[model samples]
Target: MKFDLDDQQRDFASSIDAALGAADLPAAVRAWADGDTGPGRKVWSTLADLGVTALNVAEEHDGIGASPVDLVVALERLGYWCVPGPVTESVAVSPILLSSDERSAALAAGELVATVSASAQPRAVNADFAGLILVSDGQEVREGSAGEAHDSVDPSRKLFDVTATGDGWAADVALASEFGALAVAAQLVGAGQALLDASVEYAKQRTQFGRVIGSYQAIKHKLADVHIALELARPLVYGAALSLADRTPDTARDVSAAKVAAADAGLLAARSALQTHGAIGFTQEHDLGLLLLRVQALRSAWGTPTAHRRRLLEAL
Candidate 1:
């Protein structure tokens, strides 16, 4: 069957791109890293206004009632900009995990920011900013609190140790974890694309040996390889989204496979990007460093490459 994204989906994704393009996200990211969440929160509000916060919430709860496919489409764009905080948790997993809870309404409206942490997640990302942290493990979910901050490779991600508090309620932890993994996979694809885009732009501008480096065979080859990998990974991510949306028997396998492919593609793009940009890519001042660090963090988020590969093998 054809796997191309329809015109409407492409247009929707472009709208997110346009919105974030105007958000000055790199500046927002720097502000977030320095403990100034004002700019970041403003961007979050912009996303909320775009109905991103309501993508996965059920219609009964005044949500857009979107499918995982639509969720991933928006998620990929969020990743491209390297938007901070628990985007996957807030936009994708939380709605499904906290559907019955009253807080879900506030979350859908962007009036509150919530996050999730489980045995799989281990640490709550952006916990310092989250108004609610839900801890779960497939059978039950409970509100939790942040105890201590843990530094992440990506400075924008503020991970924290979490402990459950208050009463517990039932939830489908398995599905939430699967959806979380799928969201991260989509993010990886976006991060990988960011790396590729940055590298290509730098190559076109940075001259070496009296000519643009992008004209060199080696540079061209590296960029071409990353492009190919990202192109291949995109379908798997979207396919898994479709599988989850349809509640198919192979949903687990599809999600796991997508995670593995995305992580690998993202990491490959990272390495290639660093090579293309040379020493400059490693420096903090360069914007490429932001996407590079994000790729490293996302490679291991939700699930590691090895873990997903193992999960895919088990399914096989």
Candidate 2:
């Protein structure tokens, strides 16, 4: 399968990114971090109108029948914008759509928003906005705060301790969990690249010893290392997405590898970026900290490097 985006896809992604940048997420980020309903809700509506909401849905469900690559492109664009909402959860609804017609309707129509718990598969992965939820054991159909959730590391993104949505949706618990792991891993690949760029820029401008810090060997090596790590991890992420898209039998193993690699790269990239900026990167006033927070949260929520390794090794 083709790896790089075709011209059409590239243009589509660029359009989304440009539109999102114009809207600005600062106010929403602040509100969400404080545990309030964020401006992302409106952004989500806007995205829906732009066709992001239905890009991967089947035509019968009012979707565009886009490829998984298309979905990845969309998500990367979202990360670039730092846009937040239940969108990821909404996107994660793919496997469920394969299982239940009702769930498919909710996702495609955008009449519902959902989040999932990393804690369980077929469980409440959806953050309770799901008009219906699927746990491994069974399904529950309901609405609103099905469980407790706290403000996430990325204030704009919400997390939940969701227990049930109260639908009859059934998921292959193992498969669902594996898919979640991979999706988050792919997200980190995009995010880590952004963080690395942030650090490199900081290193060049911030001065030390009568020169730009980026000129120093220490900073240079670190940036180089991040670049290497991201390059290695990035293709693995694309491979996993491609494997999933291809409906390959090795999807789980490929996904696990991608997740572990990308998550580590992301954490290191964030830390290095912070260091390059010296003390200021640690402050909430700067943007690097936001990426750092996202790295920590996504790495743990889906599966740590250690956790993914264990799962992968067991397979071997």
Against the true structure, whose lDDT is highest?
1
lDDT of 1 at 87: 92
**CA lDDT of every candidate:** 0.90, 0.68
Off by over 4 Å in 1: none
Off by over 4 Å in 2: 94-100, 118-134, 138-145, 156-158, 165-167, 171-175
153, model 2: CA deviation in Å?
3.8
Clashes of each: 1, 17
What is the lDDT for 265 in model 1? 93
Which digits, one per residue and each the tens of the lDDT, describe model 2 over residues 1-316? 5457689988988888778877766566566566565475677777877778776566776667676667777776676555655555566545343444555655665656655543433224325344444334333323324566556556555555545444444455455565566667767877788888888887778887799998899999998999999889878877877887887888878888888898889888888887788789878778667777777777775667887898779767
How do the residues 1-316 of candidate 1 rate in per-residue lDDT, one tens digit apiece?
8977779889989999999999999999989999999999999999999889988888888788988888999999999999988998888888878957777788889998889897668899999998889999658898898989989999989899999989888888889888899999999999999999899999999999899999999999989999999999999999999999998999999999999999989999999999998998988788888898888988888888888888899989
Candidate 1 is scored at a TM of: 0.98
| lDDT score at residue 55, model 2, on the 0-100 scale | 65
| Consecutive 10-residue window with the lowest summed lDDT within model 2 | 135-144
Judged by TM-score, which candidate is best? 1
Error of 1 at 256 (Å): 0.7
